[model samples]
Structures are given as structure tokens and as C-alpha cells.
Target: MAIQIGFETLVEDLPGPRWQALFARLWPGYRAWFLRSGAVARPSYLESRRALRQHMPELVPTWQRLVELAGGGDVEARFLSLWCPPPYIVGCSQAVWIDPAGKEEPALLRNYDFAPALLEGSWLATRWQGQRVAAMGDCIWGALDGQNEAGVAASLSFGGSTVSGTGFGIPLVLRYVLEIAQSTAEAVALLQRVPVSMPYSITVLDRRADWATVFVGPDRPAEVTRRKAVTNFQHRIEWPEHARATHAAERLERLQKQVDGPGTLEDAIGALLQPPLYQSAYLRGYGTLYGVAYRPASGRMELLWPGVRWPQTLATFAEGRRDIVYTPGAEAPPDPDDAALAQLLTESRS
Candidate 1:
């Protein structure tokens, strides 16, 4: 059976009941994931919130609104909104290129691999007032990766560093870049300046086909490169433990080979969907959720699985074109309170 992925628009003024119900549906699993790290103490909530406000002050309002809608004042929720501690997520490959010949618009292909449990019952498209993004995270306000109407496509991969320090989560950074930056250059500037909690890489492509991959973390200044392919590792693998998990060096070599070879976009994408690059969804946690190709110049996007393709565009998306929900067997069932919560949410919508 195909998993269901919902598509909808999001706005700042969310109804209390609807937001509460969504939180109730998604929070249990998210909370479990948060607690598994055991990194933050109960009293650290205020500290985390202060850091987020001091660094990325723009998100404070968004966070407060979400807290209010989730029935107000949950410190864990607030801390999570600030940063996600590691065993950093793994298994993603991102590549971008601009044809000097201008034969084709700049395109980016990405495969987001993570624990299937985190992806289950997630929405692919979420729009908030000035920005629209596709994401697969439990946070109603963040994005794993997404593209905006301004022709900027942003994607992330684990940066292959085990170190943690005072920094922000990459998902919120992705959301912030897409919402505020209009060009690849602007996005790169923001990525370089933003303090990320973990080692992470963000590949950004713009309408002009200009692209850049930025490596960021709390401990170092961002390393910006114009390389066409970026996997998990940076210039060199700093964390030996994560080297194999990210497959950093191998995937980068493979992607570069495809880029150097003569072929169409189809050939490049086909290469990305195979072994080493495209991970299978086995009983294991690190599995490929989906593949996406974004052409920023045209605002054309496609989501792909083995036999499924869903096409979407910013100008025409009322809701997403197709919807699928993916719930792996390992995921817990809906909360017992969902029945009543769903009813209350519906009442509020009317």
C-alpha cells in the first residue's frame, strides 16, 4: 500500500483547535525522539529559548504562536524548536549544476533518508503567508528541506560531525532561508551566518542556476564551496564515527562522475536513484523516503518513488497535487485521544 502524504497551506493565524489536534497527533513520536538523546535537562528550556532568541530572533514569534496553539508553555517543545541534538540524522545525497551552455535550467536532486518512523503521516507541502515549502518533520513550523516561490531550492544533509555546541537546528534554518532570502547568493550568506547546532550542509539553487553548498556548525566559521555535489562530509571527515554512516566520500565521487559524463538530466537522476545514493526502505531506520528534482527557473518540481511521480508548482498549488501517508509498521498507532481531538479540530475549523 502507498503511504499517504498530506498537502496543505499554513498561515500564522492558525486556529487553536486545529493546531492543538495536529500537535496531539504528532507530538508523542516527536517527544520520544527528543527524549532519546537525553542531552537537555529539564531546567535548560529557558537557556535554549534565550539562545534561539538572541541568535535567530525572527523565529521567536513563530515559536510563541505555535506554543500558544499547542495549549501553551511546554518547555520540551520550546527546546526542541531551538535545536535537535544528535546522533545526527544520516543518508541524504544532494547535487546541483548549471549548464554553461544554458541548455537546461539549474536543477537539484535530493534524497532524504532518515528513520521512517519520523516521516510517517507527514505533510509534503506547507505554505505560510509569504513562503511555501515541502518538509517531513514533526515540528509544524520547520522543514527538513523545501523550495520557495522565489526560485530558491534548499536542501540539507548531515554534515558528518559529532560535535555539538550552542547552535540552531538546520531545519529551522532551511525554513528561514526560504522564507527570507530571494537568491542563491542571499541564501548562502544566511547559511554562512546562521549558527547551526550540529555539523550540516545545505545546498542552495536559484533561478539563475547559480548554486553553492555551505558547511556550518557552532564551532567553526561556515565553509562555502561551489561544488556541484555534496554528501555528508565536509572538506574532510571530522568525526570518524559518522564517516561510514554518511558515506560521504563515496557518494561525492559517484555524483561527480555522473556530472562529468555526458548525459541528460534524466541520466543524472537515474544515477541518483540507484545503490549508494538511493537507500531502500528496509526494516532499518535509515531509509529513503522520496526523491525530488527541483528546477528553480520554472518552479517545476516532481516527487518520485519507484513507480510514483507527483508534480507540483508554487503558482498552482492549492493543496498538493497528490497526497500519500507513509506509516511504517514500527510506528505507534494514533493517540487514543485522537477521535475526540479530531472532532474538536473540525469544530474549530467551522
Candidate 2:
């Protein structure tokens, strides 16, 4: 049996209603769970939205709807993941399977079981929000990575050394970056200013194409600048002895070598989706759960996942596998019912 993968592409203009509808169908249990958890506090959601509006006023209404869903706790965890876009470009792997065989009609539809509820609960507890910002870990239904409208992306790996005293977990920060930033530089600026207390690596890719990896641990903050790509582990020039011995860094280095020459978006995706460099327990431990590719030029994005176990590389599904083909200038409507997000304000007050 192999892991299952799902894909979705949301245009800037698609009516919010459409997304709400799709969300209802895909993750029916989200709303009930959200209400039961009490994770949707009024002030938190309001603050998150206010912060977000400061950067993109157009998102005000959407943030409100998110708030409403939060109050009833009816907002399902999976729906939370699907609702917002990642703050920056991100990609990662996981160790679970929906279906070992690829014969299912929808491919990865059954794979949702791999991520259980404990992960979902942890994600909600770690969620972050301010007047104009909001984000959560284990978003998209407990997937190990995600971001917010702020332009930040958080991908995770089970590396060595586990330190505690959580400031703001990496996924929540990723969500915050996306909610507040209009570009990559702004995201980096936010990281530098904030005080974090976890040991994790976050790769932020801004809309302007500037990329940076911030390594947060119990000691100091180390950062690496990137242009073409970023992977797990340390990649910054500022860090000397910080690099770990995990396969994550080695795979990223190997891919960097292969792309020494000019490459297309497809080439980059290929390199990212390929297997890890040195085969070991880490390879299977941190297998890719999914891959997120962002094209700032067109405001377009793609989420790729390994369709089968072996031989076939991951497939890109931004708008249907064969729909956009990762080209430039691809356009879609921003979801409108998302406007109902404003309604969340009223619901939260109640």
C-alpha cells in the first residue's frame, strides 16, 4: 500500500461560497469539532483579522467568516487548513498512508485516516491569532505543514533534539506570516523582531521572491538566505556548526547540486518531489506528505503529493492535474462567500 495525495487550487476571485461549499463536503466534521474545542475565542479571531486587514483590507470579510466558524467550534480542523492559503512557499513529507494501493477512484481520498485526531487537537491548541492575523499548526487536518495569508509557510521534520517551552509554534508563526505580510521581506522582518522559544526550522518565501530560513532553538536564532530553493535543516550563511546529520539537509544539498544549471518550475518541483539523498530510517520517517509550489508572478499555486509508492514522481494539482500545467498568468476567481467571514465578527460577539 502507498500513501494517498489530494490537490486543490483556489483562484483569487473564486466566490467564498464555493470554498465554503467545498469545505463542507470535504471535511464535514470540522464545524462540530471547532465548537466543542472552545478554541475559537472572540478576541483572538478579532485580533487576527484586524492585523490581517492592516496588510490586505480585502481580507477583512474573509477573516470575519473564519471568526464565526471559530465561535461555534463547528469549524472542523480540516476545514481550517483548507480555508487559508500558505504565507510563503513550502513543501514537506510525512509517514502515513490513506491507501497502500492506487486503485481507488479518487486516489488519495482514503488516506485522510493516517492523520488522527490527537494531531488535530494539538494543532488547534497551538493556533495563533491577533486583530489582523490567524494561523494554526497541523492545519489542513493535521498535515505537518501550512501557512496563513501572511505570506509564510511552515514545514516540519522529526529531527533530533527536542526542546520545549513553546513560544509560538512554527506552524502558528507560518500562519501569522501569511496573514500579515504582503511580501517575503515583510515575513522575514516579522521573524527577526519576534521572540520565539522552540527548536524548529521555518522557510519563508515572500511574494517578491526573497527566501529565508530561520532556525529557532533553545539558544539562538540562525538564518540562511535563499533564492532558488529551500529544504529542511539549516541553509543560512550565518550558521556554522548548526547543521544536523539528518537526511533532510543532505537531500536538499543534493538537489541543489543537480540544479546547478538553469531549471524551470517543473524542474524545481521534480527535484523537490524526488526521494531523499541518503537512504536511511529518516527517509521513511519524514516522507513527504505534500508539496506546495507558489508562483508569485501569476499569483498561482500548486499542491503536489506522491500518488503511488514507487516509480511515479509526485503530480501537481493546482487546478486539476492537467488544468494549468504550472504556467504563468493563470487566473481564477477569489471565493466570494468567503465574504461571510465578516459574519464571524457577529458570531464571536455572541
For TM-score, the strongest prediction is 1
User: For each predicted model, how many residue pairs clash, with residues at least 3 apart or on different chains?
Assistant: 6, 64
Residues 163-265 of candidate 1: C-alpha lDDT, one tens digit per residue: 6776676777887887777899999888887788778889999988788999888789998898788887788876543455445677788888877667778
Candidate with best lDDT: 1
Off by over 4 Å in 1: 1-20, 37-45, 84-87, 124-129, 134-138, 318-350
Flag regions of model 2 displaced more than 4 Å. Answer: 5-68, 71-137, 140-160, 222-230, 235-246, 277-285, 306-350
Work out how many backbone clashes candidate 2 has.
64
What TM-score would every model get versus the actual structure? 0.81, 0.49
Clashes of 1: 6
